[model samples]
Target: MAGVISGHPLDTLRIRLQQPSSSSSFSALKVLRSMASSEGPLALYKGMSAPLASVAFQNAVVFQVYAVLSRAFDSRNGRDPPSYKSVVLGGVGTGALQSLILCPVELIKIQLQLQKQASRGLGPMGLIRRIMEREGVKGMYRGLAVTALRDAPAHGVYFWTYEYTREHLHPGCRQCEENTTTTLTLGKMLVAGGVAGVASWVCCYPLDVLKSRLQGEPAAYTGILHCFRKSVREEGPAVLWRGLGTAVARAFVVNGAIFSAYEVALRCLSSYQGGQSPSPAAE
Candidate 1:
């Protein structure tokens, strides 16, 4: 929630920037300032409800699916610690599953975010109902394929980078010392998650730009490939990375919070269930 709120302004700007437009001189900061001046400061958080409401479920599905798949793969290979392949597979599975849920959530969110830009005068629910009335259930899932395309590799890199960073940062875990503490410190958690977040976005940002365009307005592009080709052809190659700066910035803070909070919660729950105090290494 904190991450979303913190990065929403940039996200809003990114969405507007990604919208198919003949005008190629769109600047992030200029767009942001224009939004603030024309619409109130609160305009930045126009579609926040969709994400805030769905984030918990979305994250739960992604992490749970990833964890289950990863564990299963590890057990199958008789590997105590899963290989990078297993981790990537798990991440892909997570992305695939999460994309199913994310499609509608993102549709609603993007529609709301781009409501002003698209000049759609409807609230979130109204927009949802309108889409349903006009395009049926499938309408809500405007860009599921591209979403999955972006997410699969993005999450693969996400988990891979996170695991790599965690393992390297706390080499003690590799030794498997009986008396060694395996607690994740706040600093380590932030660093690993932040790096993972940046790596994931940097790896898949172009796909994300395409996904956003597809989801934002279907009329702009015929299909995913069409959108890709048109984006490159019309806007030049730089258009593919329109909002990358804000995206990477947002990913760092959001993923950092996600991992840190998840780790803290897991440790707290384990300690409570086991009737034991928190580990000394978990500061």
Candidate 2:
């Protein structure tokens, strides 16, 4: 929730910038200015409710799924240091499972965010009702396959990067996996999480562009490959990389905050489990 709240403005910008309609006139600066000026600053967070409502639960699912899959894939079950391969595989499973719940939430978010005027004043439930009215339940899952494709390998790379970076950052430590008792320097944790986010976003932004298009403009394109070819043919290859800057920037901040919070939460949970409490600074 903290990460999502902090990053949503940039996310809104990134989504707008990724759309097919974002022409030469719609640079990041211009989009930001236009939205703020016309719709008020709050427009920057137009679609945040959907994600905000679900992010804690979503992240819970992500970490839980990743932990389970990691142990399943690793012979040592994280008794020994975990392998990068197992980490990636675990991430893949986590992301695939995440997509099942995420697809509809994101579909609603895209619709709500893409609305031109806040004067329309459509909340998440209203948007969902509109979607159901127009296309029914199947419409809610518009970008499931694309979201899975984008997320699976991206999340694989994501967890692998985090694990690799976090491990090397404190090579002397045994490193914490499920053990919430172990802690690393907060700064290093932030770096690992931020870099992991950047790696994931950069690795699969093209698929994300395709997803936004599919979900945002359902009638515009048929399927993933068709959408890709059409976007490339019409907008050139650079289209796929549109909003890459905004996303990368947002990813760094958002994931950094997320991991930091995650660590803090773990310590809190551990403390409640009759383990050592975090220091004042950590608290």
Candidate 3:
């Protein structure tokens, strides 16, 4: 949710920048300033509510699925608890599967944000209804391929790095050796998640750029291959990395906060459900 809210404005600016006319007419900074001036700063947040709701629902579902799948595997393997690799794999699988739910919300949000400067009369609901009316349900999923392509790896890396750090960095964390009452620490997860976020962003940024362009600038691309070729040819290779800094910054801040909060939430919930008092880790 933090990621969705904090990043929307920048996301808007990014879409505008990809428009061919926007490239020659305005720099990214100018576009941001222009939007603020013309539409008010809140205009940059046009579709924020959907993304916030999406994030909350998606995270809840994905994490629950991951935990359940991991536990099932652990029981089947008789390993007492799963390995970090199993956890990471579970997370990857969850992320990929969740793309089905995620894509539509993302599509709606992107369309809404970009609609601020729309060359058409259709606003958010109108555009969505039109897509449903014209292209049926599938239109909402127009760029699912690239979304899955980018997110599977990005989310895989995120979970992989987080689990890997927890496995290796703190001796016996996997065994809960500090104490049964002691859950994973927020500070620790924040540090780990921050690192993981940076790694994920770097590894998957180009794909993200591709995904964004594919969704926000359909005329600019025919498919993923064509998107890459055209982005390079028209915007120069570097433009493919246009909002990388903002993305990385967003990942560092948002993921760090979310992962930390999640760990704390999970610990608290576990404590409450177990009929045990909250531990220091829940602090």
TM-score of each: 0.93, 0.92, 0.86
Model 2 per-residue lDDT tens digits across residues 1-283: 8788889999999998989963755588998998988888888988899999999899999998998898789887447766778899999999898999999989988878888873686789988888899989998899999999999999999999988887788774445544543457788889989999999999999999999999989899899999999999988899989999999999999998887788767766766676565442141
The per-residue C-alpha lDDT of model 2 at residue 7 equals: 94
- lDDT, candidate 1, at 67: 81
- Tens-place lDDT digits, model 1, residues 66-184: 98887776655453667778898889888888888988988888878886643647888898899999999999889999999888888989999998898899875533422226756
Candidate 2, position 255, lDDT: 91
lDDT, model 2, position 52 = 92
**Candidate 3 structure quality by residue, lDDT tens digits, 43-134:** 78876766777788888887788777666555455545676666667767777888898888877777677765435345566878888998
* Pairs with backbone N, CA or C atoms under 3 Å apart (clashes), candidate 3: none
- Candidate 2 positional error at 15, Å: 0.5
In model 2, the runs with Cα more than 4 Å from the true position are 118-121, 174-182, 278-283
- Index of the highest-lDDT prediction: 2
**Candidate lDDT (C-alpha), each:** 0.82, 0.86, 0.73
